[model samples]
Target: MLKTQFPLASIFFTFSLAAFSSPANARSIAIDEATRLPLVKRAQVWAQPTWIDNTFNFDDLFNPATAPLGSPDEQVLTKGTIDCTYLYEAPNGPVGANPKFKCKTTAQPSLKLKVKYGTENGEVRGEVLGTRLLWALGFFADRNFFLKTTNCFGCSENPVNQKQTDPNSATTPVSFSPSSIERKLAGSEVLKLVPQADGTTKVSQGWGFEELQMVDAPEQLRDREALKLLAVFINHLDNRKANQRLVCLDGSSPQGCTGQTVMMIHDVGSTFGG
Candidate 1:
């Protein structure tokens, strides 16, 4: 009789523990000021910022920088022809498996392209979807454009298979058959090369997730948690330090981020899939 009662008590205690630790129960806790994020509407997050040019900006358009800093220019390229000069292609990988290239475009000098060809399950579609969802939810996301066709000047015959001999040299032309790409995505992830007074170009290095702990008064704890939860919902498995970026909108230099810095996930390619 004593042994049976002990076992029953143990089972009841385990069940109670599990119930208390569940997410549903945890959300019941009272919200505090320190943890609550400021009032944010789902629609307001989709408003387009004024500054679209990611390159050089000297005019008064840079003033009155808004909160939730978006990329300089955030829009889709569906109308005109996208002519790009192939700069370089990154080494292939498994986690964020996709053919990506650093190309210089007429509109955006520093443009990153994700190409989808053959039978590849590339991240172009997933990335575009993920960024749009995040942007709609009031988060800074890369300005992505899906182009059905693009003219690649000085491109390799088989770009997807082209291996990089030297990743440092930007001018080294890997010419093939001048690739005529079909189904590609253009996004903004490169640092802005702002010209300084000393006749030199300055670029700010991006920040990692660990920097969130150093977040000042502008960032709330709930905001950070919301991002993490969103990542889970989007099935963003490759949520690493290199994929996330923290940029500044001080409008000074590429690295001049003294005013208001915005945290965004540039690489959402490995998302929206179970």
Candidate 2:
């Protein structure tokens, strides 16, 4: 009787241990913030700032030398923030089995303005005009914001050649692009680009604009939708496509060859008429 009872007790103890050590339980515990210090640290590291120099500005679009600097923490733009990293997810497949590709996103806060030119009104106007044009055209876009700074230590000076400059160039006391530099400066947000899944990489533009050569069949319906939106934007203001894209997915393959079609329009610098 003692032997039989001992065996049953041992079995119960093993089962309890296994149940407590299951993967589901471990996953739930991992998701708890208190228990996931390592994960939080990793996320912070991944989000560290990678600066781009010499981005373009449309300060002339607003009244020059009149815009007043707003507080740094003020939220000038309002829109849903997207997890830009996911734009690079390859088609469904076993992890580590597919070829890796380079991916990038320009959706982060890219613009910083000098202290003298910073004003709430100017920031709002720039954001509204750019966002309205893209939204009217039915393309995915990012919201804009303003950053005010008193010193010119690490701020972008030029609007056009920002990506080509040395990241550690000497600091200047004025605003200057590759073309010219000025003593006082104001900054504006610029559009960003990110790499998408393989085989789904095609971009489109407004009427009279050249279509980007892509690998997959173009979705006519989505193209029409984009065109309609473009028409509305152009009618309001002469908006041109700085960047355009189309994406497709297919169910038969895991390589993004056949799936729902999607379009993106980016970078309508400034409005023409209104």
Candidate 3:
């Protein structure tokens, strides 16, 4: 119960696979404006499923917390106060942090604060646990940490758009109680082709993005497919583009240098127990 499902409209993506090409070659992608989804030709389902890479590492995330706890004024890492006035973009929407705040520190140049309250208390835990699981599985998930905080700098500021976010709305807020503060990571995982069961062959890559009206380079479709599985495992029900990003695979693909694109899972707060 960690996600909020997007509208179940039939407006999902479709693929145009009339022609075939090598797994590494760039291809064309089309979209249906009515559906707002892409058109891609899917590969025939394989019984053996030779698309996934078996190699993965989880040493950094699984480790126990050892850093000493401190308050925001004292610069304690385990916990701290967020200067919300340094606000970036508080959409005043329920898509994410009620009022996402910016944090500027020497070690963490671009950290953000996300608060969870009432029934959404599990959001913090879901985010923490989901990060570990996705990172281990070798899919793209950004860095986020769950922490407790009582201070919110901009807790009572008047909102910019009173209609999008009513002053008395339960979901929109300038400040929150001891909340779930999530620190944005410096960077995250990349998408690339994995060696097939044969050990050296490339099976699948790339997907068509209808929103862009262009089919991009090939990516081991398994990587994105695996994300679907990871979401299920973490109980992430809201896997919409609102929580995802099409990021560059960073030099990790078979080419050993950055060029192609991959679907990056940027938000996992919708996992765990939303």
Candidate 4:
């Protein structure tokens, strides 16, 4: 009889091997001409998986809501006012269908807010649950929370519809009003930024799935394969670069990170429900 005390280990190893053993299923990754060079260069650093120490404390997995991240009480503190400015990037051309904006508050100075109205609110719930699970599993996930109701201080009158109508429009002067807002709080998921030709820096971008093939480090091969299985287990349908980020844990621009490179799941809203 073939058996072992660690069934989970057996299962994990089996899945990873089945998925990664063959090159027959491999396919070419789509390249973004604008970001190709930058992304390729970045792959040397960001493609490294965030690994736990060989002697890492196993208890941390069960206590994800606590320190090095936050406490359980802090996770539930979701309702608050956020001052925001509209972002011009939209899927519907000129204006956005699902309004997104940059936000700030007294405590959390920087956040990216994605508001989904009507029947799409499930995404918010999925994000909260998905990230919680991923975090507990020791994956790098954004410190995010979901709000049932909040005061969006600088949103337009009808942010979703109105913002899509006029390209030159801007949010009215900052004001507070209670709204049934579904927004994510991106507190510490700072992404690596690449320098632009105009002296500005843009958030480092590329799909997480693409890196599954690109990660060449022998030490990280198992973890990299496991992440592929994890995505399928979570039903993560949206595998775009925008939903995930390659971050520098230590160091600065150009040189990027001198210590650790973290591949973070920036948004898991499309997961579980996918």
Candidate 5:
């Protein structure tokens, strides 16, 4: 009886494995030219499986109120006025000012901004226009959301969803965690690898651009393929500085840093119809 049962169980397990492992059932959604949609639209279509499970929502993170509103004299990062409250904590103490004036609740490892607006066609619209041009050029970029006054307050609202790669490798729609010191350092290293024309280089250890000499170390050549792709993307976007970078595990170890090379893009805020 035991022998017979053992064989039966083994056969059943084999069959179950075959059924579950079928390629048809294991396939992922295809990404191709024809199927390619704007990242925002793709997020909406695939939200349930791709974003919602990863803790993303349309109304939560992208709210205009969550973005800082600019002052009349200030320069806007994009078109329209972003809510100033989105940038900082309210001025008052516990009682605070108007509830509407208070900052929106946010999770840690997030991006924060200050209150300020840019000139109409100058700052705000220019950023947006530049981003749009970059997207058309086929570079990886960030999405910008337009906010209304009502949306700026805590009233029930949903802003347009834009889809961009998450900087966080661990999360969906991955974005870089500005809070992570290690990640920041990794971004700096990538900048050092890419070369520039002229005597000066385009990237540096700091946040913005500065004129620096280019290095031609042999190890830098190992990253040529990845760096070339990244440079093309940045140049197409008219990137003048190291804003954001993409990072991946080194090839040799796959699990550990080989010190060989990985790719990363930084400060994507200015990307995709900013």
Candidate 6:
């Protein structure tokens, strides 16, 4: 009987010690505010004083300078005709892709062309206006223009012999189907070429950088809350990571880009209240 009682007491003591020895809080995870990011919808937005177009005017991001926007870098090609196909896609991309293609033109050598679908969603207008607005405000945005969608004849990598009746004249060989039928890329289609770049651009999706420029990091790249506010102002609801990209000035990949880089906002499809 004494031996059994001693064993029972030992078990109880072991359990008690184990219970008291447990950690006060969950040691599995350590929440660090410094490294964590807030939810997109819950992100904080603050107004800051900014100088636009070399003018010292008291303005916030929501209301940027109305001055005609110009390029901060010499590489930004503001005008061009998109006559080339995308390098990733043949003649044209899958119908699901952003109506992009390739062209052979002397307008500007972006080599790739992106076209807008139609006016129902105003994607072309949205992309054009949104990019222009951002570029005007000094953000790295692509150069887009209102181009003629009728130029897509024989632009498809996989050509077809079938014919479809035109909506207006009831004719064959229509190039404005899946594309904006009645408008230019803006109305029928919006056109833009990939801006030519000499430096290796860091292609990033989320909020981080490879090699941050010391002087401009704090103002232009880091603390990009102003950009968020601007996105909100433009009604860009599709602020997903897929819609954003980054590039390095030295032509290095993100991991190899231990140099200066630029941030770019693309596919502003859901803009102007869409």
**lDDT for each candidate structure:** 0.42, 0.27, 0.38, 0.45, 0.26, 0.36
* True-structure RMSD for candidate 4: 10.9
| For every candidate, C-alpha RMSD to the true structure in Å | 17.8, 23.9, 16.0, 10.9, 20.6, 22.2
User: What TM-score would every model get versus the actual structure?
Assistant: 0.50, 0.29, 0.45, 0.54, 0.27, 0.46
Using lDDT, give the best candidate's number.
4
User: How far off is residue 129 in model 3, in Å?
Assistant: 1.8
What does candidate 6's lDDT look like per residue over 1-274, in tens digits? 0011123244335323422321100011111222112221122112121333455332322122232233332122222222222123333222433443333222434323444544353665556566655554445555555443434433442223212222342222224322311111110011112223775433223332222222222433333544555666667777664455443334233123333334445557667753
- Which stretch of 10 consecutive residues in model 5 shows the poorest summed lDDT? 40-49
Give the Å error, residue 37, model 4: 11
Model 6, position 12, has a per-residue lDDT of 36
**Residues 1-274 of candidate 4: C-alpha lDDT, one tens digit per residue:** 1112223465455334423322100111232344343432333221222334575444433232332333333433343334444443445213223333433333443433444433354554565556655554445665545443433444555655554333333343433232222233222233344678999765554355766565434544455555666777778877777676554444433433343445556667677682
Tens-digit lDDT string for candidate 3 (1-274): 0111212121011011100111001222222222111212211111121112344122323332422122342243344333332343544334543433343333444434444433345665566566645443334445444444433333434232232323343334344444444443332222223456776743222222232223233433333344454456567676654465444433334323233344545677767565
Residue ranges of candidate 4 with Cα displaced over 4 Å: 1-76, 79-96, 99-102, 106-119, 163-204, 208-210, 213-217
Candidate structures ordered by lDDT, highest first: 4, 1, 3, 6, 2, 5
lDDT computed for candidate 2: 0.27
- Count: clashes, candidate 5: 35
Candidate with best TM-score: 4
Compare candidates 1 and 2 on TM-score and give the better one: 1
Q: Candidate 2 regions off by >4 Å?
A: 1-128, 136-139, 146-152, 156-242, 247-259
Compose the digit string of candidate 2's lDDT tens values, residues 60-146: 222222222233322221221111111122333222211111111123333222121233223233443443334322233333322
Judging by lDDT, tell me the better candidate of 1 and 3. 1
Look at candidate 5 and tell me the lDDT of residue 53: 38
Candidate 6 segments exceeding 4 Å error? 1-102, 106-110, 156-223, 251-255
